[model samples]
Target: MVWPIDLAVLTLVVMVAIGSLMVKDLLGAAILFGAYSFMMCLLWTVMGAVDVAFTEASVGAGVSTVFFVGAVFRTSRRTRD
Candidate 1:
């Protein structure tokens, strides 16, 4: 396991996580969440957990992102506040 690569991916995961939370747009947040999940998948792959990584990529990044985007599309784009 290369430490630098792991660290870079880890940093990306953290940044994406924070960006997902900070974004005002729901679709943008969902996209960031997908990116965070993909980064986590890479981390899992680096740790030799191919099965877990596949699950994260399929479920966390793929299905959930689609669900979030679908739900976002059904809602009003204007802010409630």
Candidate 2:
């Protein structure tokens, strides 16, 4: 892979991560985290790690999102801080 592409992906991942962390809403953060996982899966696919990408896509994007949403529903959306 070329350096530019790698850099771009890395930048995207970092931006997503930062957004996830900075978001006050748990649901929004969860969605952004899922998006981060998807971008990471894309990067993995580009690196020829199909199996890992599949797992990340399934677990990170799907399962984790469900878990986060469920947790959010079980609790409150508002945060003190």
Candidate 3:
């Protein structure tokens, strides 16, 4: 099936990925990464890959994002510009 939504989600994923890498702030990067993961989940869902989408939602957006945020907060070292 031709999916216009997949293209949109892909575009959003790319933009979020680029923004995540470009940001200097650790917290912002983490949030952007989470957004990227969510977009990936959406893309997979659109592509009819429910298993992959669910995994991405749980591991990428959920556990990974939470881990990053928690680690950033727990760490004493500050991110350099």
The TM-scores, one per candidate, come to 0.90, 0.90, 0.88
lDDT (C-alpha) at residue 68 in model 2: 93
What ranges in model 1 sit over 4 Å off?
79-81
The window of 10 residues in a row where model 1 has the poorest summed lDDT is 72-81
RMSD of 1: 1.7
Instruction: Report clash pairs, candidate 2.
Output: none
**Local distance difference test, per candidate?**
0.89, 0.89, 0.88
Error in Å for residue 74 of model 3:
2.1
- Estimate, for each residue in 1-81, the C-alpha lDDT of model 3 and write its tens digit: 347887778888889999998888889889999999999988888888999999999999999999999998897325665
How well is each residue in 28-63 modelled by candidate 2, as lDDT tens digits?
Answer: 888998999999998888788899999999999999
Steric clash pairs (candidate 3): none
TM-score of 2: 0.90
Relative to the true structure, candidate 2 has a C-alpha RMSD (angstroms) of: 1.3
* Tens-digit lDDT track of model 1 for 4-70: 8999999888989998888888888889999999999999999889999999999999999999889
Listed per model in order, the count of residue pairs whose N, CA or C atoms clash below 3 Å is: 0, 0, 0
* Residue 14 displacement (Å), model 2: 0.3
